[model samples]
Target: MLILFGWRTTIEQLRMLSLVCGHCHNQAAHHLFRRRTKPTIFFIPLFTISSRYGLQCTFCGVSYDISKADALQLGAHV
Candidate 1:
């Protein structure tokens, strides 16, 4: 899965780290090997003033600003 924020990518590269065998008697487990799937991407707009910026996740009620870099280290792409 790839997550893009502006020009920066959260998951730049992906590899199947590991695979586990499914239960032989489980019907749901049989479908686990299905190939095609689509990923859902969520985007939230942030307000920037001067060099300061504020961001909030719409999915979750998490509010943060650029000034709080020590706690939330947000990186900007040049």
Candidate 2:
């Protein structure tokens, strides 16, 4: 018998916030997402091994890796 195991990362959009893009210099909507990497057994997610976050621009479609504090600050609606 053979067993297949591996690691996989799942990305999910958690929220949307209005922010200005530095590269494009445009005030537009941005999306915040959560990345969870888990161990997979036979193509089934077993447990989360690591977690991360990111931000993506809605207009230019540029993505960025950001810290938790920065993500919260940028997520503020004003």
Candidate 3:
């Protein structure tokens, strides 16, 4: 029997916030995202193995990692 199992990562946009970009120093909208990694069996995803949050500036395209607490508060409205 052949068994196939691996990990899959998926990124989802949680919400958007108007904030200043750290790199470009421009006031613009930043996209909040959730990145989740899950174990998959035969292309079917199982429980999440790990999760991360990020904020990306729309103007400069620079991305930064955010804390879970901040992500929850910002994503609550969405």
TM-score: the better of candidates 1 and 3: 3
Q: Which candidate has the top score in TM-score?
A: 3
Clashes of 3: 0
Computed on alpha carbons, the lDDT of every model, listed in order, comes to 0.29, 0.83, 0.89
Tens-place lDDT per residue, model 1, 1-78, is: 877553211211111112122322222211111112233335543433223333333333343443534213333231
lDDT measured at residue 54 in model 2 versus the true structure, 0 to 100: 86
- Cα-lDDT of candidate 1: 0.29
Ordered from best to worst lDDT, the candidate numbers read 3, 2, 1
Tens-digit lDDT string for candidate 2 (1-78): 999999999888878988899879899998888788999989999988887788899999999888777767766321
* Clashes found in each candidate (C-alpha, N, C closer than 3 A): 0, 0, 0
- Model 1 TM-score (2 dp): 0.21
Q: How close is candidate 2 to the true structure, as a TM-score?
A: 0.85
Q: TM-score per candidate, in order?
A: 0.21, 0.85, 0.89
Model 2's alpha-carbon lDDT is: 0.83
Off by over 4 Å in 2: 74-78
Model 3, residue 49: C-alpha shift (Å): 0.8
Give the best candidate by lDDT.
3
Model 2 error, position 71 (Å): 3.0
